[model samples]
Target: MSEYKFLTGLTSGFTPVIDAGFSLEDYRHIDLSVQNEILSQAQLDAPEAFQKYLDNFLLAQGGQIPWGGYNEHRGLYRRSGLFSAATEEDLIRNIHIGLDVWAPVGTGVLAVLDGRIHSFKDNNNFGDYGPTIILEHEFEAGKFYTLYGHLQRESLKDLQAGEKVKQGERIAALGDASENGNYAPHLHFQIIHDLQGKEGDYPGVANRKELEFYLSNCPDPNLLLKMN
Candidate 1:
């Protein structure tokens, strides 16, 4: 079976990764793409300003969770040399491949499906997923992986490679700007069909050239969550 079909068929209802308090009704899909005119480069360059905008956005919308960004072309990574180190235009990785759930620090991050800890690490970089964890799952004929990024360091404290994580169980907590790669507090969740031998971290964004391959490899996370 195809990876996308395998995933969508595995879940019958919405699967959430963030705190359980907020229902589907509480999630407001916020646009962080290049097309969003209200957001400026300056705001995204600074986590505080971007967070203030998000606060106001949630307030204006009367929501608790602001999520989206799968396959989105974002301008949020331009400020960091992490994504702009490439000299070629097509080599710049600007297309986001994960779903971001924006929330307060310490928000509980749950496991979407029954899986065991494949790997975990503190990928501390200027624009990186600070404390990340990858889980491996297999049911019936399908086998795949899930990545949870921007988590608190404490989440990785007692974690072991083979540690089992039950579905809907609290596995991590959201990290702030200091620990979450200098970004606002959020959970970066992604579905990966193949890790290519990488662990603890994988490319959350892809360049124009590798977009096709990455898109197919990393299926849209909504296939499982069905949040929107």
Candidate 2:
């Protein structure tokens, strides 16, 4: 079966990755892409300033969680050398491949499905997913993975590879800017068809040149999230 068909089959309704206390009604789609005119380049490069913009956005929309980013062409990654292009010919990895759930620090992050821990790591790069976790799930046809990034430190301290986690289980908590690669507190949730032998991490962003392949490998998180 195709990736879209398989992913949509995995969940029957809105699957909560952030704290379950916040219902689907609390989720509001946010645009962080270049299309959003209000997002200045300077603010996108500053975590505190970017966070303030997010705060005002939520307040203005009367939203608790501003969730979006899958396949979005964003200007948010230009801040970090990890994703920035050094030369004019270099490919810029600014298209986000994962769905970002914006929330406060220490918010509970739950497993979207039953799976075993694949690996864990603390990616400390300035624009990286700090304290990452990848979980492996098996189906009749094959296996796939879900990655939880930008997590609190304690989430990894007690975790081990191959650990079993059930759906809705508290697997991690959102991390603040200090520990979570200097981004505002949020969960970068990605679903990967092929991990490409990586662990505790995977490309959460892609460039225009490689957009097609990346989008196929990392299907839209909304297939499972069903957040309207």
Candidate 3:
């Protein structure tokens, strides 16, 4: 069995930007739990409000919503698995493999542990994350990696592959909607134990069929973030 450490300090120590003219604390007070409950109970309960949320998210990114959800398989994005002809034709399709912490643009992103830059890329697409970075760390008993997506372009200006990064190092900054692949500004953080022959990017989420493999390779980031 693997012993996990609670990454509480890092999650609590960072000050996250919540929204325009607001802080993360303020944004967290928006009663997302109630909203989620209402959404679960009846989609019609707050249709207009929900639409407004989507609109605001789209406006922030300066792009339209992608054909499907990038973080998870359920909710609004899963209604149509037919995002594109290519995706529809694929044997294995969209699966989210990360934890998305929605916040405002320009939020600071910090490294959770000491590591080296594994790989990175500017995966810009209508629904894709803008600037993404992955770090590889080898522990005493095993090797693992952490990925940060939807980062600002400037964050990558100074980083390079194989560069050493310290724990708690400011790795990147959150990108605005326009620069962050046209989605609401948020950090998609994932823990990847195996690359599974993938580089530059891996599935941030997975479909039900592939859930077992992904879950084994990608453990809960909250083990490191302790945000919950």
46 Cα displacement, candidate 3 (Å) = 16
Say which prediction, candidate 1 or candidate 2, comes out ahead on TM-score. Answer: 1
Please report, in order, the local distance difference test score of every candidate based on alpha carbons: 0.93, 0.90, 0.61
Q: What is the C-alpha RMSD of each candidate to the true structure, in Å?
A: 1.1, 1.3, 7.2
* lDDT (Cα, tens digit) per residue for candidate 1, span 81-174: 8998899999998999999999999999999999999999999999999999999999886789999999999999988999999999999999
Query: lDDT of model 2 at residue 55?
Result: 90
**Residue by residue across 121-227, what tens digits does model 2's lDDT show?**
99988889999999999988589999999999889998889899999999999999999999989999999999999988899988778889999899888888899
Over 148-195, each residue of candidate 3 has an lDDT whose tens digit, in order, gives 888999988977899998876778888986777655567778888888
lDDT of 3 at 203: 68
Give the winner by TM-score. 1
Collision pairs in model 2: none
Order of models, best lDDT first:
1, 2, 3
Indicate the residue-level lDDT of 139 in model 1. Answer: 85
